[model samples]
Target: MPTPHRPSAPPAGRVDAIVLGTSAGGVEALTHLLPTLPHDFRPALLIVVHLPRHLPSLLVEVFSVRCRLPVHEAADKQPIQPGTVYFAPPNHHLLVDRDARGPSLALSADAPVHFSRPAIDVLFESAAAGYGKRLGGVILTGANADGALGLQAVKRRGGVTLVQEPSTARAPTMPQAALAAGEVDFVLPLEQMPAVLRAWGDGGAI
Candidate 1:
């Protein structure tokens, strides 16, 4: 077997999971960010986006084709795994179970937060509670302030938080909100986010 690249083993302050929140212009941002990663990129990623409850999700289809990582819609109680990507299906709240030995998914019909069913705050808060400092959060391009508070929650839990820089985003609202709400560890453009996250996945990308 080929030896693993030393840098790929897991970075300092290594994070095992990432939770992303995006909206409005997210598809374009995600398109760029997902396609560039290596298949073995270490962090298990979960994401949420606002969508109509009745509509089917194209996110899984889109990212699966665009990303090297395996991608799918989250199923209730499914355990979180490394080397994969999961997207919250339209209409439900997607949450992470904090139990490390048995990290799991939770689906809920809880009323929408920030007018979104799969609200960013719900995902981030759950992830914070579950993963604590092992989690990393990114608030990408969007039309609303949904992710700002959630990103704060992640920071409060000692997890790293990142926000897409407003000027670089296709939609500036969400990123702006996140930045305005609290300080984040990283403020990156779309192109840099994947690289930054990949660096975090392996070892310190700082």
Candidate 2:
């Protein structure tokens, strides 16, 4: 068997998709981040926020009112569309997979990891595999360590990784864990993330 050559790190402005993981303060964090993205922001945004599995998720409805992009709750086997915001639906883990047609979203009802059905790790790992160097992984405010290893996996694939600055996060544990993993490419305040994403969306430096 031959070793596969990994591509060089992608330019900050070359991001094709984004996968974000947050928990405890997710709604507030997303409220601040989504509305600030430029209307024409190009990369598709995928998100996972910890929620009760049994109840219906209203995340798409809530975010659609404020987000610059159209928001949709991910449905199983749906193709990922650019410039859209997709949220993991309650009770299922959202995953990204590449097929002959292109990248598509998948939903799984497997047992929970880190006590979360829609675990951040599940989404991050799958997106990292699907998008590789073109993906950008973000870890935001949360109380658990769900996203740490998955973010590291993104970095290992030469993808850019960002973590919220611990001091500024509503819950610092998640960001702190990712930072401790020693793979994050940037640590920034939440207020600055949307601008960075906007710049990346514009093909400008992040």
Clash pairs, candidate 2, are none
Tens-digit lDDT string for candidate 2 (109-173):
99999999899999999999999888889999999999999999888887788999989999999
lDDT of 2 at 178: 89
TM-scores of all models?
0.91, 0.93
Error of 2 at 25 (Å): 0.8
lDDT per residue for candidate 1 within 1-206, as digits (tens), equals: 97666853444647889999999988888888888879989888999978879999998887887788999899998988897899998889999875656788888999999889999999999998888888899999999999899899999998888898899988899999999998899998787777788777887535
Worst 10 residues of 1 by lDDT: 4-13
Any runs in candidate 2 off by more than 4 Å, and if so which?
A: 1-13
Q: Judged by lDDT, which candidate is best?
A: 2
Global Cα RMSD, each model: 4.3, 4.8
Candidate 1 Cα misplacement greater than 4 A, ranges:
1-13
